[model samples]
Target: MRERRTIIDAGWILLLLIWSVTILFPLIWVFYESLRTNQEFFQDVWKLPSELKWSNYRKAWEAYGIGRAMLNTVYYVGASLAIGTFLTAINAYVLTRLEFRGRKLVWGLIMLSLFLPGINALVPQYILMRDLHLTNSLTGLVILDSLSESAFYLMMLAGFIQSLPKELEESASIDGASIFQTFFRIIMPLSTAGIVTVAIFKFLGLYNSFLGPFIYLSDPKKYTIGVAMYQANMIMQYKTDWVTLFAGLVITMVPLVLMYIFLQRSIMEGATMGAVKG
Candidate 1:
């Protein structure tokens, strides 16, 4: 049994090593490619860059309007992430804590929506947004996403809220704390790990969201990072500036990488933890 366990552990470690290389190689390759001039890239696609042409990043930023698109992404992603996470937390709190009629039914509906592919609502959502004159406006995108319901995250946060001790609520109420006060001051604070986990997930989703932004936002100034990257791809067909495109992608990816690196410990630790105390 000991020998078998050792073999299994070794195999797992080997697999993980391979997986890490598989993921890291492309990012390293792209960083090198971004530093190469178009001439050097064509000369040898895999060769080390003789000189790092940092100007590629500048050109990509100015020519592709990635700077503007990045700012737009900041607004679009920030507003949506904040509103969505708060609303999700509130919904989770209510669903788990407050007793009401048809609660199970509402939860069931949410579960049903979770199973439903979001693509099914694509056409109708576009029509609604277009009719409301929301298309091509970043503010419109913010409003639309902020109000949109996501049942998946609802369930994620609900589990954490539900795991919390009822005694906390009881203790707050005994001190004459109102429901809102108990929730905001006690529940919200206790559910910090879970809330942070949810916020991180929401931020990642909002940052990478492509189709909705592409379909609704028509103006160049309003383009998110995803849409701007797509536009860069379109430009590549006409003018093959691969190095600059790679630089833009590298720029887009660095922040996300840093964010995940900083919060990775939280994600791992938060998943199994709750506010419960003995």
Candidate 2:
């Protein structure tokens, strides 16, 4: 049994290493390329840099106006994560814990949209945003993103809620706790794993979103990091400054990488809870 377990662990490690290489190689290459000068990048795309160019980020940051763009990105992401996660938790709680006449139908409708291509709604969305004067505004992007709650995330939280013993809520009610109070004090605290999982997901989604900001934010200063990266890369057409572009890409990815590292435990637990319960 010991030998069998060791072999299984070794196999898993090998699989993980392979997966990491597949995902990380391109990023590593990009970082390495960011150190190369324009001429070096053009001449030796695959070769190591002769010197580390720490100044690449400074040039990229100034050219991209990434400071203001990053600030805008932060506002967009922070608003979306805060609003989306709250609404999702509330929606999940209602669907799983509360009784309603058309609960099943409501859930069914949400589920049906799961298979629909999100791009199909872009035209209508753009029109609506234009009509509402939400275009070219950060608030508009946040509001739009917040409204489109992820069905999968809601389902994950709902599953976690369902798995918890109802007696906890019952006990709270016996102590004269109102529904809101019970949710805030009892359910929300106990469902931290699920909520944290959903928050991390929404954070990642908002952080990396390209389409929403790309379509809505016409102002360059209001652009997100993703859009800024696109702009930086586009400048390469005229300037051939590939190093700056790579540096911009690295900056764009850093927040996401740091967030994942910080919340990985909660994310794993929440994901596993949903899978196990459902």
CA shift of 21, model 2, Å: 1.4
lDDT of each: 0.89, 0.88
For residues 181-271, what per-residue lDDT tens digits would candidate 2 score against the true structure? Answer: 9888887898888889889878877887898899998899789888988887787778888898888888887888887788788788878
Reference-based TM-score of each model: 0.95, 0.93
Question: How well does model 1 score by local distance difference test?
Answer: 0.89
lDDT of 2 at 70: 90
Q: Native-vs-model 2 lDDT?
A: 0.88
lDDT of 1 by residue, 1-278 (tens): 99999999999999999999999999999998999999999899988888989999999899889889989999999999888889889988999999999999998898889778989998998999989998999888888888887887777788888888899999999999998999999989998988888888888889999998999998888899999999998988888789999999999998799998998999777765633321
Q: RMSD, each candidate, Å?
A: 2.0, 1.9
- Give candidate 2's error at residue 28 in angstroms: 1.2
